[model samples]
Target: SIASPWPLLGPGQSTQLIFGPSMDAAKLEEARMLLNGMDYSSQDEDGDTILHIYTAKGLRECAFAAAEKLRDLGRLDAKEHKGKTALLVAVTANQPEIVQDLLSLGADINACDVKGQTALHLAAHYGFPGVLQAILSGRPNVNLEARNFEGMTPLHCAAISHSVTTKALSATGLTDVHLQAKANEKLSCVQMLLNAGASLLSQEIKSNKTLLHLAVKEGNIDLVRYLLRIPLPNVKDFVNMKAHGHTALHMAAGLHGNPYQEEILQLLLSRGADPSIRNLENDQPAHLLQSGHQGEQVRLAARCTPPRGLSCVGKTQCIIYPATRIPAK
Candidate 1:
């Protein structure tokens, strides 16, 4: 028989067990034995159960084992003080393997926290592609469009998220590698959500901004380029989508000092964004261009004449023009 690492306690003597970073296989086995002897449904001061504590500590083996027992008891979806289940904790912690394990064990994929954020929302908002993928794969009836307290969907959260890598590097300073990786991860999250039938056109209730509006406003040039390239039936309509009467072009043009402002303005024009469309302030994109040489360049790009067979219809409407077709001086 395997010797127990724990000492024999007297009839009424109880001792606390301390798990440390150096815990080994024997310690884990002893811990498992200890856990098996206790009530799995127990809750702590914050209402965190054994599963929540193990999951938060990143104890995958112990957490999943507890999850299995909790599932058997029909308490897997149990919430703690903040109404977060073990599954939600896994995603928030970016533990993809644990997330997959919980999902396989029948955790609630759609359970929301007190803030109304589901696993999908947390994964997307934090740029955890692995966690997002795990949730997508395991979800039976996942709500892709579920809105959070901010009235933003998972896609909305993804659109505005700076990548985890970028955030980490901000304090140590940034590198091209960091920026490119951030762009790729952000784009990957957006693409996955879109492929799973998440709507590109769903606007957040607060500002009525679509994913396109959010991407451009974030000055994410790569994301903006990728978004515009998607083959929607009415690409022009999508390009000119309004948020509070301001089209994406209006937002880009109004980015007075953003480094990517000129490039984004040019890209929008190349993609048939209607610069003539006015915002609630009745300002066309060109009217919002900053003052100076670079702004003049952006203004020139927007003011390029319509192609041979198309014409500006009115002060508020115009035929689309690709920037490549601008007439030579």
Candidate 2:
């Protein structure tokens, strides 16, 4: 019959049914029933039970049914080939209901996959604030500082995610702290991790870049501002820290045409960033400005405020120049 894909299967052997999302409710039931009638512990090569596949595919009904069967069978924590649990799959699939169900069934909330990423990392990276909150509320001991293979905590992932929402910013009463954060900004994940005790001092295992460096490189102006405002232990190290022989200001200076780059440069400067700092190429932040198209803007900004006394002479008068248009490229 179609159900018997594995002939000559031993009693200890595991197998799986290949089902599709297009399968109707009736066909799905039939597939589940057929599998239930056979080995109760059947799994695919990746060690995924039918439950893992259903959760991964966002098949809530199928996943629920499989979870019900597996929970009673004491297989709720079964690991796939990569050590991923059904709970992890549900988080990755954005299936919040399934995630809650698995958690209610006593699934290990802090379970790490092969890459050492927990559900928190996935939720943060995907910007699922609700799911992240659910996980945190359910498991208070869940390590907020768990580093994935890339040496990134949930905080790092939140910084890198473009979809991250700032619901936590309001919930944690941090709205007033991040004044520079735009209205309805998608940086609440950073606030969430910080409130949950994620470390700001943590660096990527490979790049040695701090959260500030990543934020600047990604052009996340709000995040850069938020990090700059953090008190205690001094964020000055992050502002001036060198990565690959370049400071965060050095990276910001090169992003000339970015509309926010000017504001970011100003923020960095106001936070005590030294423009004189040079990179490996012996390039100062001002020297890294792009030429041709952005040269005029950079030059004007560089000239706007001269050294405290260089151009003032004995007079306190500051010269104001008329705005001139730079010829288009």
Candidate 3:
């Protein structure tokens, strides 16, 4: 149903636009004429309309033409099945020129989809700063906390993508009237926000995760160091503290093939992370080491090697070679 009324649409006010096996232009034209005669602004099943269909299908010409028609009908702001206006779809598709065209036709930039996300939110969520810039320049409600299914705001979205390091992303941060978030790991943009006094420990909406967990999961030692320098979060902090009551060290072990295990271990130990911290099985980091080469490495790390002066060749700390060098008496 996501791609519906393809190549044709039928008249008679039916919300059912998805007819399988392709449609005919003559049929679509007849339907369009009916809708035009009825002064109907748009049609959709549930809420998807021609604009959504065109944007999703990348039918650029059709979409552009439909947008113009919507403008003519003064339905440029008309929402489809889920309160998703045409403009939101264009931004999500990364068609900036289309977005500009829609905006020029007075498509509502502040129009919210079913999830209460605006064009600006969608643009940011998709990491299209050009689209986001177009939306923000209009100076819509920056304080509007438009949420999605996850109840996350646009600032929350900004925390997870590359835009964190981009000037385009930074530009939008200036206009967030709510000053809602202070950090996000995915986008890495939260540092700038925090640097501007965006609050290093602002609360997350759904999860208990903090910047510590985010850094640990991402394995960004620099971020970990930065966070450690700030507050030194504990199990009580916002990040995940359950499962093993683990800290960043525990998380590092779970990280795949931790090449810098030694370095990370040293840092954590220096920072007061307890090496004897046990898991649910009551196993410490030492106990987690298995036998063989890995065991040897772990033993070496823990300074558990045999005494150097007396060697039983890894079996014993002291070895006497059967008195081979003993007296000839």
Which candidate leads the pack in lDDT?
Answer: 1
In model 3, which regions exceed 4 Å deviation? 1-40, 53-74, 101-110, 115-121, 138-140, 143-146, 158-202, 210-212, 220-256, 259-329
lDDT of 1 by residue, 1-329 (tens): 11112222234432222112232567557667767888988888898999998898888778867887899899999999998999999999888777877888888899999999999999888777777877876355999999999999999988778534334445456566756565466567777888778998999999999998987886766677778778889888888889999999888977787767767777776677876677888777767767777665655554444346544322222223332233443
* lDDT of all predictions: 0.75, 0.68, 0.51
- TM-score of candidate 1 versus the correct structure, residues matched by position: 0.79
Q: What are the runs in model 2 whose C-alpha is more than 4 Å off?
A: 1-39, 57-74, 163-186, 229-233, 302-329
* Candidate 1 stretches greater than 4 Å from native: 1-33, 163-183, 301-329
Residue pairs with colliding backbones in model 2 are 46-81, 166-188
- Clashes within 3 Å, all models in order: 0, 2, 8
Residue pairs with backbone atoms closer than 3 Å in model 1 (clashes): none
Q: Distance from true position, residue 73, model 3, in Å?
A: 6.2
Model 1 lDDT at residue 214: 87
Q: Which candidate is the best by TM-score?
A: 1
TM of each candidate vs. truth? 0.79, 0.67, 0.45
